[model samples]
Target: MTTDHIGDVTKAFIDYVDHNALHAVAPENVLIEAFLNATAAEAAEVLAHLEDDDIERHLPRVIVHLIRRLAAAHKNPTPDAVAYEAQNPNLGIANQPSHLRIVKYITDVYTSQIKGDLWSVAERVAADAYTRRVGEDCERLAQIALTNVTAAELEHHIKTNVERWRDHGKRLRRITNHDNAPTNLKAVA
Candidate 1:
């Protein structure tokens, strides 16, 4: 996964590769002189290992990898740091939200076709796992970010509903795990 040019870490390059893959264009033609600042020969050499079909089949995953590299570069600026981060597919906090968005895009634009095809079981599984991992991370991140917010909302709910609870002793007791007025009222106090 060595990048031939630092431009490989750019969003523009990722988008170009994605678009070309979707349109069934050869990767060799991806870096033509007028495009993305690379010569056609350079692009061909960089992508020599990739057949057009390979690009189409693996483009989503490749995009994710490039994004990871881009994020790493943005954060650390060192090639070693970027390469190390790219090797790990797990999302990091600095770029989690954006990465999640890209993963969603990949699933919508690429995985649907791969999963729908009966011959792509392995690819479907990989895509499903990647999306599932991203989802789990996002859920955990949201919970961490929302803990105080939820508690504040709950406190507001209790304040607004205190009178109704007092009117219905049974409900208040049920909620507070107590039969006495003092214990039940302690919640709002």
Candidate 2:
């Protein structure tokens, strides 16, 4: 809620803290550092509010108190509250057309060598492209960073296919999340 002075306002700042919690160090030096940068009086004001009981509750209280002090220090971000997008389009737009060209060219090459089913043709094209992209070190770990993930390709194949089972969402939709997940079983023998 907005107030004339920040010290009069109340808010739950758990969202920011929770989002960054996985990467944050215990006692939250990252958050403390942000608080310290605001001012000494602000630091004392915030650190005084940190609850030291159950850490699940305590850490978030500390984070919220720290964030409030930091917010009070600055001019508000987006004081005008207008949204904006990037002025320039990214190179990925250019890259997508080139990707389609590569797929078309490779598919043609494989088709000429032997007439086959569309599925086999696509698989061969992908394998050929992979081999051509990485000559010798196909399975090497260091090369994986340079490799492109075919995130769309498999989904595209399943979506466009004639088989009813191809729609994995409908075929495999869970009644309850992870209720169907397999657990490790040890033999009693």
Best by TM-score: 1
Per-residue C-alpha lDDT of model 2 across residues 1-189, encoded as one tens digit per residue:
346445333233555555445334323323333332334444443333332221223333333332343344542212111011111233222222333333342233223322333222222333333343343333342344345736575445434442423232222222112222122234459
TM-score of decoy 2: 0.16
TM-score of each: 0.17, 0.16
TM-score between candidate 1 and the true structure: 0.17
Task: Give the clashing residue pairs of candidate 2, or none.
Answer: none
- Highest lDDT model number: 1
After the best TM-score superposition of candidate 1, give how far the Cα of residue 94 lies from its true spot, in angstroms: 32
Q: Tell me the number of clashing residue pairs for each predicted model.
A: 0, 0
Q: Compute the lDDT of residue 53 as modeled in candidate 2.
A: 20
Q: What is the alpha-carbon lDDT of model 2 when measured against the actual structure?
A: 0.32
Q: How accurate locally is residue 125 in candidate 1, as Cα lDDT from 0 to 100? A: 34
Write one digit per residue (lDDT tens) for candidate 1, span 1-189. 566556666867889779856643222122111111323342232222222222223434444344334433444212233234445556443333343544444334432222222112222233333444445545655565566667666566555455433433333223234222133344664
